[model samples]
Target: MNMASDHAHDRPHEPPSSGRRRFCQACIGGAAAITVGTVVYPIVAFLKLPVRLGESKPVQIPLDRLIPGQAYYADFHGQQVVVVMSESGPRVFNASCTHLGCNVVWDTAHSNFHCPCHGAVFSGEGQVVSGPVSAPLLEIPFEVKEGNLIIS
Candidate 1:
């Protein structure tokens, strides 16, 4: 064969596809997926974060207006909380159960709060008395300001 023919034959042949281009495309797709997940994860998590102190705007409630020994519910800082006036003083606690975030109902007959979701029982002071709950009721930071209950 001639010199040109020999040189052309010596050159390595490649498939129609470009390996480097394919690799780069795959890398770009992976990076895009990661970016989208990172951005969307936080947005969804922020929206789902449970109600905690300072997250809900605090409010002042006229606790004295409520009948003593009776439980009343009010929205405190975006959280559904129960306020009770006992001989000790005003008690404020989150109405949500610690076990599964279920709405607890006040058992006036039993003088305690009961979770209908799992039958968890909590004292009027928000202390867990029975059931599968490992933690006590969440207490709202509160103080009696001029006979009004201020929860923060």
Candidate 2:
């Protein structure tokens, strides 16, 4: 009774609307862009050199402020340094332990530098005293300039 109409209904459906297709394409493109950005940003950041904002200035401390048998800590070029005033004169040393790079603490009572991490001890003159380290504490060079201890 209605063969033509039945054949029309049996035909394959039309493709999705262009607006929906465009929306799906945009979503896929957005996801791909996000993935690429996430992977690329860290690599770019790692490869780029960091900016050195300021010059490394010399560290200075007044000789009058230093007391014998007491320790003075200072930051030099982003590294920790220590000054110990003994009866002989002023001595400066890198506070980090040569064993594992641990910061050494000044023991006023014991009159030496102690590494808490490995129990390494260093004399006030930066000589190795005891413990697991073979190398002595690194001595930093300095000069007495106008009564101020200057470490460059």
What is the C-alpha local distance difference test score of each model?
Answer: 0.84, 0.92
| Per-prediction backbone clash count | 1, 0
Best candidate, TM-score:
2
Would you give me the overall lDDT of model 1?
Answer: 0.84
Tens-place lDDT per residue, model 1, 1-152, is 69988887896765547897678888999999999999999999989957565656666778658776788887765568888877787788889999999978988877899999889999888888999998999987787788787877
Question: RMSD of model 1, in Å?
Answer: 7.9
Error of 1 at 118 (Å): 0.9
Model 2 scores a TM of: 0.68
Worst 10 residues of 2 by lDDT: 11-20
